[model samples]
Target: MTGKSQIADRIAARGASRSAAAAAVDAVLGEITSALAAGERVTLTGFGTFEAAGRAARTARNPRTGEALEVSATTVARFHPGATLRARVAGGSGEPLGAVPDLGSLQGLTASEPTPVETPVPAATSSVKAKSPGGATGKAAAAAKAKAKAKKADVKKRADAAKKADAKKRADAKKAQKKADAKKSSSKSKGKGKKK
Candidate 1:
């Protein structure tokens, strides 16, 4: 995965020391994380915008058990890729993107408020409901919860197995020690009798 280390390596290759490059990456990420935690947004020019959005409480179905459950409202971080970034990923040649938003305009925009765009919808899917762009839906939260529970159970099972293996190892080591001691004592006793 192209993580912080990989980015730092690239930066270091460009002339900055490795430590300095790593520090720069850490500082950037740290600032973004803290800003999001404080209910703010961090916009990287020509990269993307990161912000926290509120998710409304709703009823969701559990994917594993197929049971209906109520999920509480929570805020989740969301990212909207900038036009430049999107273009870099998706090859150009389509309609050119609009003018990039100025930093002043971006700063004035709140995390919860996204710029509105009007799109013409065909009649085929007009009656169907579409997911809200504000934040994650109930189904997404439920799926995340299910995955987390599975991971926790797997970790616990592995930990219990590890404990049992350690206990057995210790017991076997003790038995071997006792057998060695008994053999040494018997050999010493026979040696003393022979000398007498």
Candidate 2:
């Protein structure tokens, strides 16, 4: 949750003015951005790499409507932290990170405070992710099964109603036909009796 202002605060704690710290933060971000924009990789030895990668155009789907979507080809930036930065962030190796600013401040650590242990961020979207192999998470699968069951129920209900309606219509037609036949027979009988 820490942003540029927070980062500036840490640098300010190091005796630089707030404005100077802010300017330094902006300058570093700007240089990294410019390098990535020019399709170059900016690697700070013990920090991380900032690079741009091209993505191919592809078709994707809208989950709710099950509709297809067109995704245009584009370039995207990616960052892969280096071993030293990773180690320090993970609280591994009690040795200090060489030349890097106090990572502690970024982690809300003041010099008086010890480095806090943190859980690593997951790389995937957790909603559909598995907790472990063959285990625990089935939210997406359960949702799909429920949706299919509801759809089948809806179709069966409509079909049953249609069949009942058709049966009722045929019975009404048959009754009308029987009534007409009775009327014709009665009229014939009356005509024959009158002629006699």
Q: Please name the candidate that would achieve the greatest lDDT relative to the true structure.
A: 2
Q: Which residue segments of model 2 deviate by more than 4 Å?
A: 92-196
lDDT of 1 by residue, 17-90 (tens): 55665566665676787888899988988989999999999999999999999999999999999988897779
Worst 10-residue lDDT window for candidate 2 reads 110-119
Model 2 Cα shift for residue 13 (angstroms): 0.3
The per-residue C-alpha lDDT of model 1 at residue 131 equals: 36
Residue 4, model 1: Cα distance from true site in angstroms: 1.1
Tens digits of lDDT, candidate 2, 1-196: 2345555655665555556665666666767777788899999998888899999999999999999999999999999999888978898654322334543434432233322222233433332443222222245556667989999999999999999999999999999999999999999999999999
The lDDT values for all models are 0.67, 0.67
Stretches of candidate 1 above 4 Å error?
92-196
Per-residue lDDT value at 184 in model 2: 96
